[model samples]
Target: MSRAGCSACVRAQEQLAQILADYDLRLAVVDVDQLAEQGDPLPRAEFGDRLPVIVLNGVEHGYWEVDEKRLRADLDALR
Candidate 1:
């Protein structure tokens, strides 16, 4: 999603990355604009400007920010 113009998006990304780091996981940032341009289903067509969306195991857990408590729980489940 659009992390460039949103401060909350940046913060969410940083927090999610930090949390996942403890589990030795790396966060993957997707270039949504490119996907949207290509007419991807979950991009510009559906999501629009809502960004910094957190997709955990292919399911949306949060948007515009990372749900820290839920994220911690989800990541912990893997361990």
Candidate 2:
């Protein structure tokens, strides 16, 4: 997730934790301003303007306010 101290990111993290309780998924919080500290070779401009981006299976899911019901159904289908 590309977050920058946004309140929406905090809320989304809480909601996602509840929804992903049974899944073996991991949530990595990537601070857009601190990527360089983590040795990320990519440039921040790629996601600078878009904070709270959710990545699922290495694909961009979307920004904040994820569809909980739809995501649950997708996870169920994955099973």
Candidate 3:
């Protein structure tokens, strides 16, 4: 989950983009603010405090930043 104008979120997305292709993974960026405007505020309510929440495989992997080393390890394990 993320929000507009979040520097951390932009950085996280850039970081993910750099590696996702290596693992044949696709990223889906969910804007919490957009969700709220669309009548679904659960994500924002649950993780509003965390601007750049990283969710991998439907489970939250981390927040604030993208732990590339850890994430790469997790992706390898998935294989």
Candidate 4:
């Protein structure tokens, strides 16, 4: 996630939330700028200004947008 209020990020987050509503998912919003300011591992260097990055199991799943179909496929596989 980005602190710059990226529109795409916001939309993706909302879409993901709706998609995973039926499942038990632990979604977190990480402000890259804040993380950088705090010297966290998730800095802009890695994530950059790309808003609404989806990370699963410590690996990036998607960025800028939520691939709903792909996400559903992944979740189905998890089940």
Candidate 5:
């Protein structure tokens, strides 16, 4: 997920962790600024502006916040 120092990202991360506790999932946190420093080129354009993004199976979910109900449903469907 694209996340910076956003409180929403923190909450989302916690919620998602709780939701997926039953399953074996991998969560990767990529710092936008750090990525740019490493020559990511268009960091903001790529994900900086879109902090708190969720990528489900390589699909861009969205930004802003996390929906607990929706997340649970998605997880259920995956199983």
Candidate 6:
């Protein structure tokens, strides 16, 4: 998940882009504020304060930053 104008979110996305393809992974960037405006406030409520939340396989992996090392390990385990 992410929010508009969030620098951390941008950085996280960039980091993911660099590595996801190597692991055959895909990323879905959800804007928390947009969810709230659409009346589905769960994501914003659950993670509003933490912009740039990274979720892998429906499980939250990290927030504020992309932990590439740990994420790569998790992806490896999934295979």
Q: Write the per-residue lDDT of candidate 5 for residues 1-79, one digit (tens) a residue.
A: 5545678778878876776766777567666677777887575567667678876776766676777777768878988
For model 2, the stretches where C-alpha displacement exceeds 4 angstroms are: 39-43
In model 6, state the lDDT of residue 35. Answer: 89
Stretch of 10 with least lDDT, candidate 5: 41-50
Q: Candidate 6, residue 30: CA error in Å? A: 0.6
Instruction: Please list the residue runs of candidate 3 whose C-alpha ends up more than 4 Å from where it truly belongs after superposition.
Output: none
- Which one wins by lDDT: 2 or 3? 3
Best by lDDT: 3
Q: In model 1, what lDDT does residue 57 have?
A: 84
Q: What's the best-to-worst order under lDDT?
A: 3, 6, 4, 1, 2, 5
Q: What is the lDDT for 25 in model 4? A: 78
lDDT of 4 at 30: 81
lDDT by residue (1-79, candidate 6, tens digit) is 9999999999999899888989776778999999899999999999999888999889899998888899999989999
What Cα-based lDDT does every candidate model obtain? 0.75, 0.72, 0.91, 0.77, 0.71, 0.91
**Ten-residue region with minimum lDDT total, candidate 4:** 1-10
Candidate 3 worst ten-residue window by lDDT: 18-27
The all-Cα superposition gives candidate 2 an RMSD in Å to the true structure of: 2.2
lDDT of 4 at 70: 86
Candidate 3, 4-62: lDDT as tens digits: 99989999898898889898787789999999999998999989898799998899999
Q: Which residue runs of candidate 4 sit more than 4 Å off their true CA positions?
A: none
lDDT per residue for candidate 4 within 1-79, as digits (tens), equals 6556678777877888888886777567888888888878556777776667888667788888888888888888889
Estimated TM-score for each candidate: 0.79, 0.75, 0.94, 0.83, 0.75, 0.94
Candidate 1, residues 24-78: lDDT per residue as tens digits?
8888876576776677756655555677778888787788867788889888886
